[model samples]
Target: MTPHDYLNIGAAVWLFVCWVGYARFARKRARTDHCLASVLHVYRKTWMIEMLSRQNRIADTALIASLERNVSFLASTSILIIAGFVTIMASIDKVYITITALPFANESMSPRQLQLKIVLLLMIYVYAFFTLTWAMRQYGFCSILLGAAPAHDADIGEAERRRYAISTAKIIDQAGHSYNYGLRAYYFSLAILPWFFNTWFFIVAVGVVVGVLYRREFHSTTLRALVRDLTATEAMKKSPNG
Candidate 1:
């Protein structure tokens, strides 16, 4: 209704656009480029290849179990956070009073406005919960695939084994991607917190959050290292003896 309201809405839209747009861009680049996700994907494929060559797979199973446990823990945490948001929504009057008393918080938020803000937080956590649960399920599928994998001494052809390894590795990679999405939701939720203070602060928070994500995803030191490592590996493969 007001300029501040329009700015708040604009900030929210911008946050959503950045979140979804970056995810798509990263996914595309990860197929052939050197970034964190792409590097990790290469490792996943290598892990599967190693598993195919190993006679003992206990350690491999343990590693997959550990990944599943991590996803489960995050899913549980998201549920708890959603419940906390609901609690806050139920006691929004007290929350509004407390927040308005803070020196920097906007004092003009009506009950409806407060409720909307709380709902936004709740929705973000809900989305995170679903993403994490889906990741957990994918990890479960990975475990199943691992269990069904042919042993190193099996009579299966090498080509078949390699295919199985690549398929399983892709599944695991997807699970990791889903987990990353859930974590991104948590990051953006933090950006939404400043909206309760002022629209301008909310916009600034959105920019800061997106900037942080962009830098980490595309320009971090870790990415550079991965690129260098990948390049060296490719060079080695092209050598006469390789």
Candidate 2:
């Protein structure tokens, strides 16, 4: 293999490491840190608890439906993207010509190399489709759980009510996690698009993607606002004004 081949291999490996490593890092940090996932989990629990007081659960179910719709939209869009990629696959010759003309890629770029890059993107979208659809189904399951929950005026014990709310919120949280994973795949996929032009560009893009993800997940303004709001809510709950 040539030096260019080695660079390609190294870049691909870097992408794999960044994608998997960042996912693991983010998840572990979320357990002990104040990221969007962890902070929103508290909000989900509070939402479920609030549902316990409403005699009509239409609003609760409606919220669940809205979440499901977002996942469904992404899943369907993934299918369309996959289809477009498939169509592109049928015209690999044109892709090879176009990519080879790029100053960075040049005439030495093999058709197989171009095909592999496209396939990598296709695989990402396929993985995203599966993850998004599963999340959509999980949201549906949350709705069922909500439906079976005790009525507002039921004789259920406090302990049981609390347990039920916790379980329902857990389902919603997990579904949100799955949705996040799907979005992560999409982010990484964007990094790969540069590979056909330059391997080093691809590697740098992967690092940039990781950086963006970390900042958004852990240090975004939205996260700060959510954390602040949650803190105030907890402080209010502990006050003795009542």
Candidate 3:
């Protein structure tokens, strides 16, 4: 087989593998009961109660820990995603996808088809680059929030303490959401770009992979589930009243 054919095969196989891994993780998590559920247990009323109860240290710790974990997850996933995009872009230049491999791909098309393929690829690259760049920015925000933490404070009600905690939590959550949105954008490219090679079926493959990933995250009965829940809660807090 040609290098191009091999690359297509590799992409398909790797995507399938990722899908399986995610599915398994989700299924396993869904079957357990764990503390991770607390992550999603956020209620503004509850937050206020914690604040009023003088348990500011506990609440603050939870918020900070959750933010750290979310940032870690995003950073790791962004690396994997950027790697995937780089591989695909490299393959686009080195390997020619076969018409037989992609039933929709026209091997003997006119110059216009080639031009369209070039344009489609450029679009994909542009989108992927932008999303990855945004992920990097969110990572930076996480770093900033981490640095802003008080060096030595064991109490709440100090004006700066309260303000810093609330502001930091909001910033971290916003950065986390941006990271997630950027990832979603990156995945959207995986689904959209293969069509240029007439392998739209790859889109289905990516969907399966993403669904598995999401299920593993939101359905996992452990800390992962908590992570997802807390993430959602954070998003809700940022949303305008409706």
Candidate 4:
């Protein structure tokens, strides 16, 4: 098989592994106690909302903890670099094949194509790495804040407690969005790289995958509920009681 073929196979296998991981996470969540399970359930649901609408709501402490755990995996950054290397190799190999099959020497290549490939690969890496690093830093900050949160029966002032809670929630929510953006970047990088092989097929395949992912994230019941909850909260905050 060609290098592109290998990459396509690798992508499929990675996707399957991710699916299994998600399934296991779901099962583990189901087996947890009601309170903890409910918290994670909502936290997971918020990501769906963010995926669909590119917006998220700050809800509970459990959500913050869960997002922190997920971000610590650094899945996006790792995947981006790994897949980007594979794509770069595939393009290079194809170029090698072109040179070898020609009538003349196989060593020479256009500077423009080489420069373009390097630029694209570096762009993907930089985008992935920057976001991943930021997410990791924010995760650490969230962890510190979570550790410092007051106990349920603490005698802290209501305003002070509320401020802490809101700030923590916002940090976690921002982390979730950052993680999502990183994942999107990784996928887009892989999808776009195939254009060097064949533009039309890569574009169509990428479009379909993107469309499916978007619909599942945004149109799901969980996301709709979260959206409603956020809207209601905003409305209440605008009122005098809030």
Top candidate when judged by TM-score against the true structure: 2
Q: Can you give the TM-score per candidate against the true fold?
A: 0.93, 0.97, 0.44, 0.53
lDDT of 2: 0.91
Q: In model 4, what are the clashing residue pairs, if there are any?
A: none
Tens-digit per-residue lDDT, 165-232, candidate 1: 99999999999999999989989999988888887787788779878987898789988887788789
TM-score of 4: 0.53
Candidate 2: worst-modelled 10 consecutive residues by lDDT:
101-110
How many angstroms is residue 180 displaced in model 1 relative to the true structure, after the best TM-score fit?
A: 0.8
Task: Give candidate 1 misplaced runs (Cα > 4 Å).
Answer: 234-242
- Report the error of model 4 at residue 165, Å: 0.7
Task: List where candidate 3 sits over 4 angstroms from the true fold.
Answer: 1-111, 154-160, 193-224, 227-242
lDDT of each: 0.88, 0.91, 0.52, 0.56
Tell me the lDDT of model 4 at 162.
60
> Which rank order by TM-score, best down to worst?
2, 1, 4, 3
Who is ahead in lDDT, 1 or 3? 1
Clashes of each: 0, 0, 3, 0
How many Å off is the CA of 96 in candidate 1? 0.3
